[model samples]
Target: MEEVRVKLPFNLAAGETEYRSGVWQGLVLKWQKEHLLLELPAEADSISSAVYGGGMGRLKRAVNQFVSRDYECSNPVRDMEAKLVEWGYPLEGCAGLMTAVPLEHAAVAEEDTGSAGIFCCVTAAAGNAARAGSQRSVLAAYRPGTINIMLAIDGWLSPSAMVNAVMTATEAKAAALADLGISDAENGLPATGTTTDAVVLAVSGSRRYAAEHVYAGTATDLGGAIGRLVYSTVTASLRSVKAAEAERK
Candidate 1:
């Protein structure tokens, strides 16, 4: 297994080859022949931004601060995003960004190969939800929650497959929250029903990767990691908020 060391939050003149997928939030996935590797800021736990307008430009700066500029990496995930934010920046909704990288790449399944891979991130916030059985009224304006997924697979997946991945991730996400019981949630219904909104992201794969694009079981490599990470990230986000509320009491 070839291991590549990466310095995060810096200018990227080109892309790396260990990864079969594209870039998400400046992080790219690299397959070490067996396991997975992602070039990310070690301090990146949860990403939050208030400057909704120039988000792209600002997101880079924010990531740079945590991964590049800042040298301190001792902060805990529970509240690292806010603590890392430079003074004077607006603190709005947290992106709840999370990435998955196996500590041991040697454990990756031998069957997981070729374009059958992914590099991804997910942000989840389920503040707003609609009832599963109830009809939604477009006229009845309501604030929607943030539930999103970003995926960069190794090959050129058909439109249907892309949608399939999204659906798969969605189901996985809902299950994640449902597992928590979200006892404090007031969003419409309970398990088997209420689901949060989401956004899926991906980039074009390499020509080598484009040769074969097949999405089988998401239990290994990209799919499995994504499902688990999304669940953890969202759960962690909810935990922080819930914990804060308890403190207020």
Candidate 2:
């Protein structure tokens, strides 16, 4: 069977892929393969489950770049640190996520309300998809297939609100997988997400917006937008992979 390349919704440049929204700028850098880079308008408050910098922090003191790299190495933390040095991005200021999925299959969705704008990017590979509670305990190892998400919002959010946003986004991801009938290969149950799924949520923390979001639940406007964007982007990314696989058959 011939290999079929999946087409992205947007164009990819020869050396670097660039995308811009009202709030942020993104570039898909070409190293040995491709990785995603997001440049913020200013230092933003972020929360993530990334391998390199996986925690709640403020992207301050020249720390403003967020990256999602495609990695298959056993030593993700070390390899990721070395890659940052090689790429001339400081480890201090950058938050990173790793995945086995190729960046060419990445999907992006954006929504701009007059008050707040949201941009979401996702790279997903679900071969090891699993429900959260269905899997048995095992030693930790680097899993190749995973779903990685990066979301940037051009508005102010409290710290609690940022965490709320993560919860909302996660629910949307599970909903996307369930809606697509993606089952856990191990348990034969509906997959909530992959074993190694990670997400990063960043907010501008700008005071320009009249309302400071203290809550982001499904009932709130911000949470509703986050859910919709994540759901659509995850669905689109997986569908692209499925389409490519079908072509190979």
* Model 2, CA-based lDDT: 0.72
Best by TM-score: 2
Over the stretch 1-53, how does candidate 2's per-residue lDDT look in tens digits?
Answer: 12212235444455435555643443222223345676666677888887777
List, residue by residue over 1-249, the lDDT tens digit for candidate 1: 322111221112343334322333345444332212334322222222221211211121121111221223343233335643533333332222221221111111111245544444433344443344554544232122244344444445555555556656666667766786642244345532234343433434445453533452375344554555455555554554455457889
lDDT of 1 at 97: 27
lDDT of 1 at 187: 37
lDDT of 2 at 124: 81
RMSD of 1: 12.9
> Which candidate's lDDT is highest?
2
CA lDDT scores, all candidates in order: 0.38, 0.72
CA lDDT of 72 in candidate 1? 34
